[model samples]
Target chain A: MTDDTDDIKGTPALDPVISDSVELRLARQIRELDREMMPERDLWTAIERNIADYPQRKPFNLQGDWMPYGVAASLIIAIAALLVNVVGLEQRNSTLLAADYAIDSIDSGYVNVRNPMVDQFRETNKNLDQATLDDLYRNIEIMAQARKDIEMQVRANPENTKLVEMLMRVHERELELLKQDYSQPGRSL
Target chain B: MNRALKATLSGVLLAFVWAMPCYAAVDSGDLAGKRVDLSEAAKPDGFVKISIVRGDLIVEGWDKDEVSLVGTLDEKTEQFIFDVSGRDTRIIVKIPSNNTSWCCNEGSNLRIMVPKGSQVDVATVSTEVRLTDIRGGLDMSGVSGDVRIQKVSERLRVRNVSGEITVHDVDAYARIKTVSGEIDARSIKGGGAFHTVSGEIVLRDVTDEIDVESVSGDIEVIGRNISLARGHSVSGDIDLEIELIDDALVEFDSVSGSVRLRLDGKLNHKFDLETGSGSIRNRITDDKPKKSKYIRDEQLRFTVGEGDGQVNVSTRSGDISVSK
Candidate 1:
């Protein structure tokens, strides 16, 4: 529309106003611009009218509205990642605890209970607050001590089959506990 | 070309591919050049061992003056092997070379047939050992393949890793140590010792002493008539059925699996059973009475058969049941 006022043509000194040819050309360019922009302008007007009449107006002032959406999407992703990581860590911890128990109990073999692996595993996994690992370690210690005592008693009473049998029972119990620990499951982590 | 001709050509090509191995040269050197043929005059010897470097070792005992083995070593393929040499007094077989390596070119399988009274010693790695109808001691060491023996009388000793030991009709002692494999022994007339890191031990119709120690896996013993049976496992069940003779002593210990002992009424022996958190049940005969102790209110001790031989049983978290 403003281009109509700036139209100047013919002899530059002849007139301060636009000449007929220049005026016509300017008018045509303006018309073409309007023709190109009319649909977009109408669509914008319709959208503005719809938003004005919409029942649910935005609660917050929508200055830089995409900021909130981006924040929400980032929160969702963070939550999903956290959940996945937590679940994975829990599973790993579970398997690790089981394996620790098995190794401590000597379920794989005759464990000496003095094995450093047991201590190292307990110390490392204590953060998970796994009571089983501690319990297993303690039980293994007790069993090992019992085995030693029984062996001593048997040696003292070599001829006494009854005492020897009782001691043997103790030894058997120790081995059984070790096996149970091993057979249950392995460490997950 | 016609479609029929093309089809026939394809069929022939397939047949040729399949039959390639059959036509391929099977070097007898893989057999350790050890082949034993039985003679009508061959006599049963005390012991026999044949160590070969290559070729199949085929041993068949008979009534004869001497044991002869013909070696057919191929000029090619330098694979390791050991086989039978000669039968002097007993059969003494050794590897002449200092080669400490082993090979399985002929699928590494040794089929040995000895007389009913012949003893054998086999030492190989990664070769399946098959022995049948031998009456003397059978010593085997360091094998990585499956070991199968049948009707072998005398002591059988096997030490290896990752191999199954199957023995039948063993008249004497049998001791085996394996890393991870199943051990099945049946009709053993003497004591048996089995040790494994991870494996199952199954015994049937065994007499004399039976001792087995394993980290895990169930132990099933049926028709056992051993005077002393001792089994220990870290985490596995001990399932047994036998007659506890007057002089028999049976003990089984496990970590978490139940101990089920089924005994004959004729079983006359004492039992000392204990477990951490499991119950113990002992069966008594109508003829002979029994006495038990709940001494300390936790430990259970019992005596039977005039309190002769002792059978100790223990476990950590499994029940001990003695039933007829």
Candidate 2:
């Protein structure tokens, strides 16, 4: 009709074709073919049977978890540390008791013998200068401190005979100083 | 001031001065004096034994062939008896029992002179004993008075109670002991043993084997060319400065007392040192210390040079210091 399709430059032009009976005949042949199909057995019943035979799984419980094993291990370590501390303390206490007994027995006899000599020395040297007296007192204090240190060591090592002997020696030295001071001929004068 | 008042004051001052007794000069002329001489009939190498009670006793050695005794007797007591029988001579200065009670206040001061190379033995109570220029063995004991010996050339033994002992220029073995006094020994050649309780011991320039022990008293030894030395103390510090001879062995032990040792810089020795509850200061070698805990005990085992000499030191609750 009015030549609605125009030929464009540098393009190929289309050719029009008339309607044919071949299309009608092919559509009529498809309508004649079978459209319905069926399987040989029911697949829903097999799925149901397989599901019934499957094994069941258990539910999760937090009470029976692995945390108790960790707690048990920690408890064992704590008990071992405590036992070690207790044994050490007992040994230390026993040593202290033994030391105290030994020291006490020796001190009584030594003090009795030292007192009179000390008194005599003090009376004889009553006229000495204050500085000399102070120096003597200071030395005595040092000796006392040394004695205390030895006693402490003895307490830690009760069977240490050397410590006991040293303690006695310190006592004797204190008395000797008092005696020697006044025993010199010109000292009292 | 008025003349009368001045005169009165002067008189008072003179009387006061006269009333104050002189305490410096002691007079012994009032006491009796005697001397006894024995001929060479008393052997030159014989023994002289003396026993006295109170006052000073002086024994001297001379180049004589006879034994002589000069006694200063107390007017209140009997004269000393001299028995020169056999090869030994005995002198007895007798004192009354009451006079012996007072120390250094009674008894005759005997001066006995003997020949060289003569053995001498003296025993006294409450009296000072002095021996000089002796060339034989000496044995002396005293109570409550000082004992002094000088220039002895043989074995010497002295024991005392509550008195000082002083020895100088001794060239033989010596054994000295005191109970509550100081011991001062110098220039000894052949060393022996010295012990004290509650007294200080000072030994200077001693050689050969020496052993010293003390309780509650400090000990100091300073010398050179010492071959073998051992020192022990309880609650008393020990100080040693020595030059070790070849193959010398030195040991020191203490309990609650510090031990200090100074050796010659050129010494070649092996040191075995240990301390409990104490620290050690070693300036002898560069060897490291062993592992310890609690008390921090210092144990040192090391050798210097070829380790020809040995030094062992141990202490408890005290310090040990070694230096070159």
Give TM-scores of the second chain, every candidate: 0.70, 0.84
Candidate 2 C-alpha error for residue B92, in Å: 0.9
- DockQ score, prediction 2: 0.03
Off by over 4 Å in 2: A1-189, B1-41, B99-106, B288-291
TM-score of each: 0.49, 0.62
DockQ versus reference, model 1: 0.01
Top candidate (DockQ): 2
Let me know the TM-score candidate 2 reaches against the reference structure: 0.62
TM-score: which candidate is best? Answer: 2
Runs in model 1 deviating more than 4 A are A1-189, B1-47, B52-116, B282-298
Candidate 1 structure quality by residue, lDDT tens digits, B21-78:
3333222344344342322223466456544323344444444434443334322223
Task: For residues A128-171, write the lDDT of model 2, one tens digit per residue.
Answer: 33433444455555555655666666666676665576567667
